[model samples]
Target: MTEVAKPGVLPARPHFSSGPCAKPPGYDPAKLATDVLGRSHRSKLGKARLQYSIDLMRELLNLPDTHRIGIVPGSDTGAFEMAMWTMLGARPVTTLAWESFGEGWVTDAAKQLKLDPTVIKADYGQLPDLTTVDWSNDVLFTWNGTTSGVRVPNGDWIPADREGLSFADSTSAVFAYDLPWDKIDVATFSWQKVLGGEGGHGVLILGPRAVERLETYTPAWPLPKVFRLVSKGKLAEGVFKGETINTPSMLAVEDAIFALEWGKSIGGAAGLQARSDANAAALNRIVEARSWLGHLAIDEASRSKTSVCLTVEGADEALIKKIASLLEAEHAAYDIAGYRDAPAGLRIWCGATVDVADIEALGPWLDWAYASAKVAA
Candidate 1:
């Protein structure tokens, strides 16, 4: 295949951004406008689509009846902040910082809320030692670190029964990995990651315990209308029923509905999991075949199946940049460079939207890029 030079143009397959990932194979944008556009979100049609999305997600994830899912404002970060600001302060909070996203939550607790927090910190590619923590405390963690491509192996490490709640930011982990709902109290995700939908909408799932906390304990800081989960000291029942706390983007909601429905049509969560697993396996094969490139994730078990982060072994920054530019100029990839804050390398989004065949095609290009790199180096 000829490599062409065009900024922002993606490979025929379009499989790379970490979030707002490539849309599902064969997605028809026109169908969205005809079916979802020109309709009021509060109308029966919109409500049905919204309600169906919630039901499908619950069924696919096997969520318990005791749990409630809400389509909320902002993306995963916004959903997480709503949970943190609304549910913390009544208890001692423990924040785990292993990657950039984890550090963000710690900052929210320390600087924004000014809550006295016990933070556990680990360098990139490592997990915070959970064994050292006190279990009788509310805890927060990011299940997958998109920037570092490191993930928590299991919720098995969390105490079986803690007096306080466990909150998770599963933006990059959902659908690609197993999340132990039993071990989590409040979990947040965005539509754009694994689902490959439009952004601006966040999903928040709260366990019964989380709801109890919301009703029984209000934060010391006043809540804004956008962040309000509890209205006048009462848990917002309507939010869980497709009634958003604020004006929501019906277009985004409709996109989420289509994505959720698409997820169901392809064998639901299992299909999404398999797609991610296959993409990751294909990348692993590439790493094994090529000596110059390898995963930045130290351990195979800890590596993310969704966002595959790889470092060009023994290559300098300039060489890595050259290879990345080569890939981009060819329109073979988009946003494949490693995150700015992380060490230089390539980060491939292997979420459900990415096909294994595309990864296979891209594998040789990695080798070609490296050969070009050796000449440049």
Candidate 2:
């Protein structure tokens, strides 16, 4: 391998983590100074801020008025668990697992909940056959597989008149991809993913059908206070009206409000999606020019624009880790290693919070890192 000169420029902010991703450009901790700390979340001021966050999210996502958006206690995991616990027993379930998180859901269904769900699975870098899904059975799947970097191309496979509800774990897909709200009955996302906000909070969106399921159907399993969505045979309206099940992180709520405002300033959902698309396109160009580096997602249609996974030809896990360490040590990138269970490679976050210029700067650093790793090997 020939020695390559170190790149002169670096990404302005070297945070490329998949979760708790890079904060929005110009993010300052002091901006959250006005957070209603040490105060009751039910206080007028605190409630107003919380309501503002919900309103902003609804506006940005173009959610229908009939949908109920609630700020739940746990992050995406908590929100997803709540949905599964509350809704899965009402009908037979079909779970599609392709990666770590999706597999986790399948485990929950088959072992924990003992729902005995029909499981459809695919290996890493590929998606399960959507055509084979039984929509008559309540379906659960991740919108984008963060570990494998593959996403469902569209919602065309979901029938309009289907009897079952669709629960989508869209933690990594929101803001970066277009979600077919008409097809999704329950959707969950975390503040830390594409929004570049603080963690410890999950946003759960329930369509009218989901709400009806909650009110009309009762699960056989025990319900924790945190997981309960209906009370007295009726939907808990206060939860959707900014009244949380438990005390929330006021600081995180403020940070989420700031991120949402920033999202709106950039032209709401359309602008955020465009930014992520451009970042992925920038990196995709580099991958196309290099024969060694290829996308972990084999199908271009299923490749994720947010968590962009790449595989280096003839590279082992150690080699991939070495390349990632080289980039981090040089301050060119951070947190670019693939998920532990994923194929040996790199995973770069191309969410809206990541600038296209930074992704462009990363190309040269990756080349240098690969060469350096090869020399060391």
User: TM-score for all predictions?
Assistant: 0.93, 0.98
Give the runs in model 1 whose Cα sits over 4 Å from its true position. 1-12, 33-36, 315-317
lDDT (Cα, tens digit) per residue for candidate 2, span 1-377: 88777889998888888988999998998987574888899999888888989999999898989889999989999999999999888889999999999999999999999989999999989998899998889999999999999999988999999899999999999888878899999999999988899899999999999999999999988899999999899999989989999999999998898889999999999999999999999989989989989999989999999998999988889998899899999999999999999999899999999998998888888888998899999
- lDDT tens digits by residue: candidate 1, 1-377: 23422333234684688977988887777657447567776778777777877887798787889899998888898899999988999888899987788999999999999887999998776776778878788999899999889888888888777898899999998888868888889999998999898888889999999999999987888888888988777789888888777767777776766777788889988988998998899888888887767788888777889877888777566776888787776767677878777777888999988888788878766766667666666
Error of 2 at 164 (Å): 0.7
RMSD after Cα superposition, model 2: 0.9
- Candidate lDDT scores, in order, read 0.83, 0.92
lDDT of 1: 0.83
User: What TM-score should be assigned to candidate 2?
Assistant: 0.98
Worst 10 residues of 1 by lDDT: 1-10
- Ten contiguous residues minimizing lDDT sum, candidate 2: 29-38
